[model samples]
Target: MKAHKSKTLIVYSFLLLFCSCGLFIDKDCFDSNEYKFYLPFTLSPAQDTFHINDTIRLRADFSHELFDSITLKYYKVENEPLMCYFYFFRIDTTPTPHYTNQFSIEVDTGNVIISPDPETALRYIVYEYDKSRYVFSVKFIPHQRGVFLFGFGSEPQQHVNFQKKCPGELMDIYFTTNDGVDNNFYMMAQSPDSSMNAVPQHGFNRSGSYCFRVVE
Candidate 1:
């Protein structure tokens, strides 16, 4: 009877260990999934140069392995009039067509909020078609003049690390010349928490900033 009891206890202990290991694996999987969801998208401009008070249009695009709904956030430095346009294209060969509602908010304090238009009651379909892609454009008139930067990312907050300040990842796009001359291209990054020291964030992960210099 003593031997049997010892065996039972051992078996129970093994089961407990297995369960704990399973929980640990599950937690790791959850962390990876969350990280991918927060991954930033790509923001590109048609051109790098723009004149002061000129209407600038920027293109934001993203592609994912799986079809996931995404919302883009746009930021600017100077308070200016802003407009956003969204386009969805189904890359798969099919007769049926999918549509997503797009919406944009009025410019306020150098920031604009854009999302799927609620009036259409449509969600941006990603996985329904092969290699689906979404493209959006942001139009704004720069009131201030100088070396200015603007960018779009998954994060809604306005934060970007400049070259001279905190540098890590390419977080924003710079616009310098208006006539497509004297264009500057570089990477900028910022820490999610401003209180932290000016250190490169690990994995080059952080929020984005729209830094631009408006010159008269």
Candidate 2:
């Protein structure tokens, strides 16, 4: 019995030692005062704007004292609300046509460089009708038919304004000659650039004219 008890005691002593060492290893050293607090990550080109056919640059920053290596994920707004094409901002490599993937980088002991490639996301609409007439439709309305206008435009501020002055807030105006389907009218406008509208040799001109009707 004495020998059995001694063996049990030895086993208990070994178990206790193992558990104590494991506990010490699991203890977090990062919360201690020996290590200073530093920002681990940063994002650049945080606030920027882009026009058609314009390119934007982006960057990421990090601290050497904080991390040994890092893995980053990139994302951008797509065709739902805003249309934008993202690309890689590679200084050493050639530019690509598409950007729909996450790029990974290995940081040595110091800084990791990440470059963003942003291209024009949206395209404006312009169509040709005749020498004196042109058609234009954009995602957002333009304040006035002009070469360049930014942001959302007012409906009334358009080249041809539509208003309801009748008893009801909504009114309709129509004319009939031969048949209801054959007699209809559509409003048209001219392009902001007169020369771009049509060829001058064809005697085509748009002089801020509106309320033009079409016969079918």
In order of appearance, the predictions have TM-scores of 0.33, 0.23
For model 1 the local lDDT of residue 69 reads 23
Q: Which numbered prediction scores highest in TM-score against the true structure?
A: 1
- What tens-digit string does per-residue lDDT give for candidate 1 at 1-216? 999999999999999998876764533233222111222233334454445656544433433322212213222222111122223212121321223321222232123333556443332212111234333434556553334333223322223322122222123222112222222222222212232223233222332233333345
The count of backbone overlaps in candidate 1 is 19
Error of 2 at 137 (Å): 37
| Candidate 2 residue lDDT tens string, 66-167 | 211111211111111111111121111222122212222222222322233345322222222233222222121112111221111111211111111111
User: Residue 170 lDDT in model 1?
Assistant: 26
State candidate 2's TM-score.
0.23
Backbone clashes in model 2: 0
lDDT of the structure predicted as candidate 1: 0.33
